[model samples]
Structures are given as structure tokens and as C-alpha cells.
Target: MSSTLPVLHVGFHKCGSTTLQAALFGRHPQIDYLGEPREEPRSTEAIRLVRDSCYVEERKRIRFDPERSRALWQEALSDVAPGLVPVFSKESLTQPEFYAAPDDPNLPERLRAVVGPARIVIVTRHQIRLIESLYLFHAKGVHVEPAQQWLDARQEEMHQYRFHTVAQSFVAAFGRDNVAIFPFEDMKTDAKSFARRICDFIGVDSQHGADLIAGERRNQRVSQRYLAYSKIRKAFGLYIPIGRMMPEAMRRSFNEFVAGGREARIELPATFVAKMEDYFRDDNRKLARDWGIPVEKYGYPV
Candidate 1:
């Protein structure tokens, strides 16, 4: 309605959402990044409207209020200066469970209602590695659970990696011509190329994107040593005291000493890897063939 083309980066998290939010999208002069990244803008009302409306079931069963959500969106849109690309970014949008494999069952219709038709951007990672990284991610949380327990096969997180299913939703919700999909591997291989593609999609200058992404990775993986340390600390009820009881320098030194040297990475079992391969192969292949993605170049499940 406002003649401003909105870009929605519906992050299937563990992809490059953080970097894109904090660096690529957030820093671009021509882009108006709204609502949430790894940074403070996270708790804003723009996207919380969608999150609250879409995920909250109790209200839905009673009586969903679409106008309330629309008001929040309209308010956010009012502040956007003309000629700047508006980007609503939140990786958790795709994963309603906050941080898990199973994506939101419903396409984000409430958000779509705000901006009649908007361009969508989706980024996906290799299933096996994505799951592995997720395990490592959760392991560092205050309560570290066993890898298997953290994974919780019952969640069927692997299915979320079927990239096509996720991407196609955006394609359907926004037009086929409006949805852009990028493989996470590309960012790993050529950050510049990846930056250019996204910048191109959002109709912004690509040059600045390159400079913004230099060594910018929020939520860097914790060291493998943290897995056991987190659990032991949780067991001892040490999730408090605000890191006091010792001098600042001594605490910093002690923490550095305990952290493992290598980045923490969960090693998936062979059987699990095989299962992931079987599950994602056809989906990935179809996605590549249809979307013209050079997925094989990255040795993805396909």
C-alpha cells in the first residue's frame, strides 16, 4: 500500500541469520532493518506481533484479534523513510518452537496480512551439520543435556531441513518471483557472492554488504569443553552470583582457562547421518533443480 517493497528474512535459524541481521541487512544504508537480530532490536513489537499472533494458541481458540497485530505492523511501517528497503528479520519466525528443528506448521499469514505481498528470503544449511551445530548450540545453555536428549528425535527436527518444503511456503505466501533462497554453504564459501545475491534481491547496493560481513558472526559456537562444564555448573547450582566471588581479572582468566580450545561440534552418529541423507536427498535435489541452486557444489545431502 505504501509503494515500499518489504523484505522478510524468515530465518530458518542456524543459517546466517545473525550475520545477516547484525551485518548485511542492518548496516546497509538503503535498508531499514526492523525488529530483532542477535542484538537489542529483538524484543520490538514489529515482529512480536507476528510471533504473538501466530504462535499463541489460547487466544486463537477463544478469538484471534487480527486488527491488533495489524496496528503494530502499520505503526512500524509508518516510520520507514521512503526509498529505503524495509526488512523484517527474525530467524525464529520459521521455527516457532524458539530453537528447534520442527518449523512452524502454519505459514505466517498474520505477518503477511500486514504487508499485502512482500519478498521473502530463506537460508538453509546442510541437515546433518545443522543438527550437529544445533546440538552444540543447546549444549552451552545454562542446562546442558545429553546430545541425544538435546536432539530429542521425537521433535523430528531433521524434517525441517527439507529445504524445499520451507522455501516453497514462502514462495506460495509471497509470489514465486518474490521468494529468494540461499544455501548457507554459499556464505561459508564466498561471503561476497552471497552478499551480492541478497543485496541484489532486496534492490540495495552490494558493495557495502561485503565490508559489513567481515568476520561478523554472532553467537559463535562455544568450545566443546563447555558441554561438561555447563552440566557440572548446573548440577552445583552455579547459575548465579553474577560471576562474583573473584576479582574481575581472575574470573576472566579462569573462564578462558576452562573453555576448550576447539570450537564445539557434535559428532553425529553414522546411522543418524545415513538417516539424514536418506531424508533430505530427494528434497534437496528437487530444490536445487527447481530453484537453480548449485547445491551439489557444496556436497549437501544431495
Candidate 2:
């Protein structure tokens, strides 16, 4: 622990977070990045604590110990070089509950306590696309919920996707100058510039790792066969890890028979998108007016 930490990239998921973590931050020679286990090569105890602690289980919010988190962070910083700026990135930091008006907003405050006023970076995308992509992301796993129900549940959490609200909360916690927001659309359009901008903001060398993060679209494609198989698993009340038990040969044959190689054309209904646009119009208008960002050009509702 030589100096105060610099940046915290608290994510609004379904953004290019995985690619940024795996390719840009993970590979950057100067930045000392810490986050999830598999996504980060240098998964320290501090990150595990952050990821494990903040969540709701069985209608109860899990507690996060600021002192313990700081202690673990101190221990984790032992390996970092004196001059390197330590960056903590976890896309799920602003957990789903934070968006609800009545819920206690402890994550940002807890983070302030643990790290003490660091720069906060929020990377988000268009609301309709964000929700649609999120549904597909869950479809990859044991999630068998009907897409309509899943999307409808999330539509209620409009504050989460408002982008400006979440950004302003961090700005409230950590001073105005410390918060920066960017669109994931920029990364998709120009990977090099997008990576460079973030690297520059974080005070790291941007020239080194831009190309590594190009063209990364993670888990947006849903498999039709898997959707059917997953529903059947749900029908039988099997929520456990039963996929491993299926014989590899049988799995391969089933995939061939079902033509699971083809990506399913899953899409959100136009009415849902229109509702989201109408809901977020005012918020997006405010975001553009305050931030001077051309959100409309990137398909955001203005």
C-alpha cells in the first residue's frame, strides 16, 4: 500500500466489460487490475471479497465489511509496484438492488470507505440493446426464465439503465471531476480509440493494448437447441449442474441433430423497446445536456 488507489470501473453489465477486463486492463503492462477470478489474471483477495459480498440471496441483502475489504486490499497491494496505479473493475458493483428507490445504496459508500475517493468509470450502452443482450447472456447458463417475464422484471428497474442517475450517484460519493462515463458503442465503432481514451483517463499507456480488445461480442448469441434443452431441464426440476453428467458423445450427437451451431434470432419486441425509450427519454435528454455527449447518434433515446 504505497499510495491511494486511482480508478474504480464499476460496470453496468452487458457492456464491453469482459473484453476490457480480459484484453485491455488484463494485458496492460502498467495498470495493476484486480477483479473476477477467471476474467482477471491477477485475481487478488480484495476482488474476491468485493464480488462475493455484494448481492441478495433469498430476499436478504448480503453485507459488505468495509474494514475487512480495506485489509484485503492492503494485502493485495503488496505485489503491485510503487508507481503503478491499481485499478479495481467489477461490472456488477452497482448490483441490481441499487436501482430500486427504497433500497439502501451502500456499494458506492462502501467503496468510498474502502478505497477513499477514486475516479469512477461507468461504461454503458443503449437501454433496449442492454436489456435484450442481458436476456441472451442469462440464457447461456441455467437461467430458464421466459424472455418476456425476464425483460418485464428488468423494465421496472429503469433507473439502473438511466445511466445518468448511476453516474451522478458516484459523482455524489466521489467528487464531480472523479467520475467519467463512456458509451460501449464507441468501443464497437473504434476499438483503438475507445481503449486509448479509457487508458488515458486511468493514467496508463494506451498505445499498448488497443488492438487486443477489437471485435469482442461476448454471450449475445442464444442457441435455440440449448434454449429447448434448458426448458426441459427446468420442466424436470433439475437446476443442478447436470450438463456435465451427460455423456460427451451423446452431447455431440444431440448438438448435431438439433443444428445447435446455428444462433437463435432472439429479439426484444418493438413495443418493449418503445416503452423503454419513452421511459428513458427524459433521463437520456438530461445526460446529453449535462455531459455534452451525442447519445442520439448512437441510437440512445433523446
Candidate 3:
């Protein structure tokens, strides 16, 4: 067996990251997938420090001890089998704050200091679909505001979809050869094929990794009616206390019961999607040209 290679799947979420992560967790003998750094106390503190130091307020900075963070990460991955590749997948690492400044080295440098040399995997979807999915995700998870209001509040963050900028930062820090970008649209079309590609990239046997291709999806989107009802419940402050009181499994079951098998359809204004498509046109073209992703295949105009 080849020596284990450390792989970090820093997600650009609203993509198929949950599906990929679920597929890889404990299913392959040659790969050890750690779901999230925050799941462990030591790694949580280390990640928090990395985030704090990397994503400070404008004109402000915070410092953290690198040696401590490194030690924490080393400890976190110590339990994995020696010959198996170590994969750490975390979706929150793609939050806009880390990439807000195009030139910032803090995020990548901190990551390098802790994880050392590792393959970086980033998965992205077209901006229009991604943003709409993100908006619904926020509404379901935390925000009570209407979609338009929530979107308005996140204008700056939406720019993270200019994927080349984010990918370039990692390329600069980790070298171009170590960075891999996959389209979420491609994954949705052929998840098994996509999983095989990732396995090949990480130097694991494709046959062994094939088992990581099928599983229950995590954080599936609820229907429009369900979301609207959630909004009303939040508006009336009826959801807050109930959400706090109920266990997560119970809350999820209750939500599923209320949704009554409604399909996962979200109805955003057509003009809104058109405008977003226009807004991301140049960036999508650049992604196609530079990264070889045929954005047009995913319905983005090239």
C-alpha cells in the first residue's frame, strides 16, 4: 500500500458535499474520512483559532499559536489506520469570511501550518442555483427573514461564487497541482463516477472506494410550503422555544410529518435567477476557460 496522503475537502456548500462525505465515512478500508474538525474538542479549538486568525474584522487581526494548532491536528488524526489515506471534510471552511479579501494569506497559511501539505478538494455549483439553495438552507437552519431580505444581507458573501478567486488563493498557497475543483452539477449527474474520480485523485483503489458512492443524503432540502410554514412559525416566535425544547431527531421527525411528502420545490422569481446568471456570467466564463469546467453544460452561458 502507498503511504497515506492527507486530503482536505474544504467545501463550497449547497453543493453535494454532504452526499460525498456520507459516502466516504467508514465505508472504504483504504480511506479514513473524518467528518468535521469541530466534532472533536481539540480539533474544534484548533479550527476556531485558525478561523479567528484567518478571518478577522476589517483593519483588525488576531494571532494564534501555530505549534499548538499543529499538535491538536496531529492528535486528531492519530487514530486513523497508518496505511489508509486521511481525509478531513468540513463544509464551514468555505464560509465567505475566509475568502473575503482576495489577497489574504492568513487562511491558507494557517491551514498549511496545521495540516501541512495536503490535497485540497473544492466543489462548486453555478451561482444562481447555489445562492437560492443557500438562502433556503439559512431559512431552514437559522434565519427567519424573507428570501429577498436574507439575500440582500449577504451581497458581499455571494461573491465567493467567483470560484477562480478562491481556488487561486489555495493554488498560490498549496501549489496548483495540489488543488482540485469539481462541479457539483457533474456530481449530481453521476455521483458514482465522481466518487471514483476523487478516489483516483487521492490514490485509493477505485474498487474499494466504490462502496463510498451510495448512501442517504444529509440535510436534504424541504419543500417551499414547508419553508413558508417555518417562516410563519418563526414570525410568530412559536418555533424558537419548541426548537430549543425538542431533541433534534424529534424535531426533524415532526418537520417531516408536517411537510406531508411535499416535493422539494423552491419557487424564486424568474427575473431573480436571470439577474444572478447575468451577474455571474463573466466569472463563469473565466472558470470555464481557466479550469476546463464547461459551465454551459450546467446551464450557465459560456
Candidate 4:
């Protein structure tokens, strides 16, 4: 048996991570894709603490102890099976708090300590699309705020869209040779090919390509009508009580009624798109210059 090389997928969420997780988990014999470290007790307690700390909205409230985290990591990986590469994936690792340079408070350093030297994979989406998707995601979770209002409230926290800064931190901690960046656009354009590339990156067999490609699409957007209904329900703070009272079947029927046999597409305002492009222009340029990513592929102004 050969030794395992740990690979971490620190996600910039809503960037096809769910699909990638579904593809890699148990599909390949050579890789052990652990979806979230906190889900299993085999992970070190320190690692769990670090993961949970980054997993919340109020990350500033969470404190980390590095010495304890390192000790726990050593114990956790001490018995990892030989010849199988361990893949740890979690989207929260890309949160903005972790990238707030100089003031990052060593969050990224703690992550490196827990994981040791490992391959870091990050998937990024166009900022505009990502923000819109994020808004819809919150709406689904009963957040009633309008898009602009919600974005304004959380703008500073949405630094996952600032790819260059996030990438630089990871690269600085983990080494540039150890990191790989793939655009989410690639996944949407050719999922099979994208899966193949990722499989190669993690030293998995591409024979599982069919299984990887077959993974179901997750977090599909709800129709605009359904989203609007969710917003209204949330605004009234009625979804909770109504949800409790409604039978599962009734809830499904209600969804179907709102969907009206097809999902309604939510269109973004052109002005908002233009603003996002301008906001992210410099960061995207840095990504192009430093990481050699084709910013044009994301439709960013170069």
C-alpha cells in the first residue's frame, strides 16, 4: 500500500461544488472523497473546530487554537489508509473573513496546519452570476430581503468573488505549485471534460467518468414565481408556522402550483450586472495576470 496525499477542495460556493462532490464521493476506488470533515468523527477535533469556525456567518466570533489543531490533525491522519488519496471538501473555506489580508488572524495558516501540505482546488464563477445565485439561495432559505438590499447588507462578506485575493492567500500558505484553479464555466460547458480534469488532478481513474457525469445537478434554481412567493412568505414571517401546519404532500402541491409546470427565470437588471463587472474588474485582472486565468472567459472587462 502506498501513502495517501491529502487534497482539499475549499469552495467558492454556488460554483458547481455540489456536483463535484457528488461525482467524486465513492465513485473512484483510488480516492476517498470526504465531503465535510465535521460530518465524521474520524476527523481530528481541532480540524472540526476550525471547519465549524469558518462555517458560520459570524466568523469573527470563533476563535482557533493552532497547537491543539495541529496535534489533532496529526492524530487524524496518522492512520489514513495507504494508496488512497484523501479529498476533503468544504465550501466555507472560501469565506471572505479568511482572506481579509494582514487582519486574516492566521485563519488560512491554521487551515494549512490542519491539512498539512496538500493540493488545493478552488472553483470560481463570474461574480454577477454568483451573486444572483447566492441571493436566490438565501431566498430559498426564507431570507425575504430584495436582491440589492441583501447584497448591500452582506457586500463585505461576499469576498469569495474576489478570486485573486483568495487565491493569493491560499497560494502563499500552500505554495503555488500545490494549487489549481478551475473556472465554474468549464463545468457548465462540458461537465464530462471537467470531471475528467478534476479526476486527473486528484490521481483518480477517469474510467469513472460515466458515474461522475451521471451525478445529479443539485441546488437548481426555483422559478421566479416560486422565489417571489418565498420572499412574500418570509416577509410576513409566515413560512415557519405555515410550513409546520402544511402536510408534506400539501407543500409539494403548493410548490407545483407556484411553479406552474415550469420554472420562471429571474432576470437581473443590466445596471446591476454592469456595477458588478466594474467592482470586480481589478481583481479579475490580477487573477488573469498572476494566475494566468483568462478573465475574458468570465466576461469580465479586461
Candidate 5:
């Protein structure tokens, strides 16, 4: 096994994954944050993998080949440790459909097979707020069906699929001792402290200090038009061109005009908060047991 495997941030997305990734990649010298030519907003290899896998499936309208999927997994692993403690933060891994069961025996086995004895970090937030933010996130990208419907479908998928279960996959693979799970809310609330905690867990120092913890919610906007465009692309199943095809001028316009200014804070409803509290209670319990976290310390209703 390679001595330095990538630090996999298997996220429960909208949990400040982008903000943390941007801060880390923006400042850290030793880390190589992967993305496309035009400062790729995303940070995980798994997104491309999932999209590509889905693309192939849609084209043939068929199921994925296990051998092919494994090959792609190997290809993703190939990029690991090109630098010391390279970070891979893809929330898709937490998606339920990816694993047969949340506690599936195959997860850790597969991860070990690919990334070797790795340290895993799982970040989570209140479910209701997560879904609301996700709605805004999806909204900011492209226009689509009714927001409530989208949320419902996503919730179903999440419940059926489960993120907490996915964490077990890593624990099974790396052993409970090697995995460090933290609350997304806590990180946002106290970035410096969280960074120190994370550094301690991963055996790295925080070069940038607490100041690196800049914003509570970063890159939090998507305009109606952007959403509409996104919806069209999704419905038609077209690629939106990965990066750098547009001129700088056009990119700026898209950022300024279409994106409705960078990092706009999303507004969420109170009801969503109530729902999330109910949803994550069990998951939090399981996570607390697995990672030895004080659930009350994070102040989640759980």
C-alpha cells in the first residue's frame, strides 16, 4: 500500500464541502485540489466518474458493468498521492444507490482494494437544512421541476440510499480507529478550531491559521436563468462543457450576471429544520458511536 493515500472527504454535500475545499486548496501548499481549467468549482473525481457512468448508461440505456466500474475506480485511485495527503471530496459516495446497503460488506473492501489503508473523514449536517440548501444549490445550477417535488425525490433517494451507512463502508475498510467523523455545522461555526482538530487527526498542520475560515456559507448562489439553463441541459442530457471554452469576458459575465454574484447566501424555511432534526437522529447516533463524537457537543437536535 502507498504510504500517502489521498484524504477522502466523503461528504454529505451542502455541508460546507465547497467552502472548506476552496479554502484548503486556495491556501495549502502541499495539497493538489483537482478540477477543470477554469478554476473548477468542484473538487472530487467521483463526480466525473458518476456523471460519466450515468452518461454511458443513458446512451445505451443499460446497466453498468462491474468490471468497467472497477476499472474506473482504479483510474480514480491512480491519481491519489500525486502529492502528500491529496484530498478527494465527493459527496456522491454518500449517495445510497451506490452501495447495495449502507453497511454493505463491499464498501470498505472495495475502498481498501483501491485507495489502500486510508484515513476517512465524513462531514454531515442537519437533514432538513441540508435538503433546503441542496434545493438552492440545484436551483442555482439549472431550472427544473417544482422545488418541492425535487426535494421529495431527493429525500426518498437519500432515505433509500443513506449517507451514514456509507460511512460504515470506510470504517469497515480502514478500521474505526482511522476514520475521523465531524459535524459540518461545527466546522462552519469554528473553522480555526475545526482545522486544528482535522490537522491533528490527519497529521498535518494548519499553515493558514484560523483566518482561513472565512465564510459560513460560500458559493451559495444560482440565479433563475442559470437554473433554467441547467434544467434544459439535464432534461436533454447534454454536457455543459467542462471548462475554459468560454472567453474570460464571457465567464465573468456568467459569474456576475447568471450566477447572481458569487456566494449568495441561500434562504431556507423553518419547517425544513424540523424535518432534518427528525431525519438525522438515528444516523447521528450511529455516527457518534462509530467516531466517538459527542452528539450533544455539535448541538444537533439529535
Candidate 6:
């Protein structure tokens, strides 16, 4: 409450980041939203910098240049919100190599310069479902291989990523008191309370955007058929506007077919699930100890 606010929603993406951003940051009267929806190679510029110069050679070069990225990020915020507290949401902020060395001379200082004394909110999901949704999301565009195949081939790479390291980085930069960790599942069910917590964090009143939260998760499901259809449409020029021209019943049938065929239970197979769980176990444990976030809140037994 002492000064202006900036809350960075460094995401463990596909954890309803879109819905939460839509309701809280996207439409909030007090918050300004940044970043492009459906932007791939998310935080592309920042990732490139991290990969090329900052990261070790053994590490994959899939990161951005944080300094330039945040400069542009802040510029985007200045353009959009003018005088308000800026709320930036980007899933790429959780990248392990990027966050691991917060004490490093270069990156952390750049982060501190852009969003001074910012409150960092990290939204995470159960690992099993999170990775699965991510696989589907990748299928939508980011990947050519099927979900299972990506898992099989990239298991070590995926598992080696210590996403929870971002929590430590934020705590190191902004202090533990400024960090708010929440389960995306809970946020989906009780957005008002979640929003209130965030409002309190940013020193904004809940009434600033309480009414706008009503339709938060309206687009929660996408059927596999629709995803496939979308890919076909993209190839053949059957766009959404064209789909809108079709009879409503026909569109509904198409959507339903995708939902029926593509939707899978969030549960993953045992070995695949175990690999992810074992990989993050220590990182999550360290996060809990450092930040007092309950290990149980992570949706897997520690």
C-alpha cells in the first residue's frame, strides 16, 4: 500500500493461466495486462538470450534475453496502462535455468529494475495434469510429435527442468513475504477469494474488479476433434469466421465431437507420472521450506 504495485504471474503454464488472466488481470479495472495471447516460443526474445550466453552449453538454448525482454515488457505496460499498477503474466518465467541464479549479477538486477519491489505470484497445478494439458497445448501448435512420443523422447529433459526454482529466485529478489503461491485448481473454484488475496498483495481493493470475475473459466475445454479440425481448417482456410457462418447446430456438433474424442481423464500412466513426480520432488520440497507453501498444495504426496 505504500507505493505503486507490479505483480508478476510467473506461470507454471496451462494451469488456467488464460482464465485467471482473463478474469483478474485482463479485465480488472486496476490491473494492466501484458503479453500476447497465443504467443509461441513464449517470451521468445528473453529465452534466446538465456540460451545463447547465460546458460551452460549442456543446457538447451530455449530461453530469452531477460534485460531486453523486460524493457520491451515494461514499455508495453507503459503504453497499455499509463498510470496504473502493471500485472504481467508469462509462463516462461518458470524456466529453471533462467531462475536458478538469481544472485547472478546480470539477470536479477534487470528484473529488479523493471518491476521494483514486485509481488511474485506463481500459479501451479498437479504435475500429472499440468504436463498432460501442456502436451495437448503443444499439440495445438508447438509440437509435431504426439504427446506420448514427446514424453518418451524428452523425458530426461522435461524432468531435469527445476521449475520450482523460480520460487526461490523471486523470494531472493522480492523477499518471501511478497510471494503468493496458489493452486490453480483452487483459484478456478473460488476466484473471488483468490482475487481478494491478490488484491491484498497489490494493495488494490477487491471491488475494483469483483463484478468482472463472473465468467472466468468459460473456455475451459477443447475437444481433440476440434483441435484436429482447427489444424485442418488452418491448412484449408476454414477459419473461425467461416465456422461462424455455419449453422449453430453444426458448430455445436463439431465442438462436441472434439470434446468427446479428444478429452482424456487428467490422470497419466503410472510410469510417465512417476518420472515427472520424482523429478520435481526435491525442487518442490525446497520451495515449500523456503516459502512455507504447503507441499500437499502441490497435489502430490511429498
Per-prediction tally of clashes: 1, 0, 0, 1, 6, 11
Clashing pairs in model 4, backbone N/Cα/C closer than 3 A: 2-83
Q: What are the per-residue Cα lDDT tens digits for candidate 4 across 1-302?
A: 22656788888888887777665544567776555523435453565578656534564446666677777666656655677777777787776655554235355667887777888898988887787787777778844666677767876775557787777777888888888888888777777777777777767776576456654576666787777677777778776735447799997777677766455455566777677778778898987888777779768555
Q: If the candidates were sorted by their TM-score against the true structure, best first, what order would they fall in? A: 1, 3, 4, 2, 6, 5
Residue 166 lDDT in model 1? Answer: 70
TM-score of each: 0.85, 0.79, 0.84, 0.83, 0.65, 0.70
lDDT of residue 158 for candidate 4? 59
Q: Residue 247 lDDT in model 3?
A: 92
Lowest lDDT 10-residue stretch of candidate 1: 96-105
Candidate 3 ranges beyond 4 A from true positions: 37-41, 58-61, 141-143, 235-237, 240-257, 260-262, 267-275
Choose 1 or 6, whichever is better by TM-score: 1
**Which residue runs does candidate 6 get wrong by more than 4 Å?**
1-3, 38-83, 96-109, 141-146, 156-163, 207-210, 218-221, 224-252, 260-263, 287-294
Point out where model 2 deviates above 4 Å. 1-4, 38-59, 62-64, 102-105, 215-220, 223-264
Report lDDT (Cα) of residue 81, candidate 5. Answer: 63
lDDT of 2: 0.71
lDDT of each: 0.72, 0.71, 0.74, 0.70, 0.59, 0.60
Deviation (Å) of 102 in candidate 1: 8.0
Per-prediction CA RMSD (Å): 3.5, 4.2, 3.7, 3.5, 7.0, 5.7
Q: How many clashes show up in model 4?
A: 1
Q: How far is candidate 5 from the true structure (C-alpha RMSD, Å)?
A: 7.0
Which ranking of candidates, highest lDDT first? 3, 1, 2, 4, 6, 5
Error at 101, model 6, angstroms: 8.5
For 87-129, candidate 1 gives per-residue lDDT tens digits of: 8887767763422333343445555665667888989887777
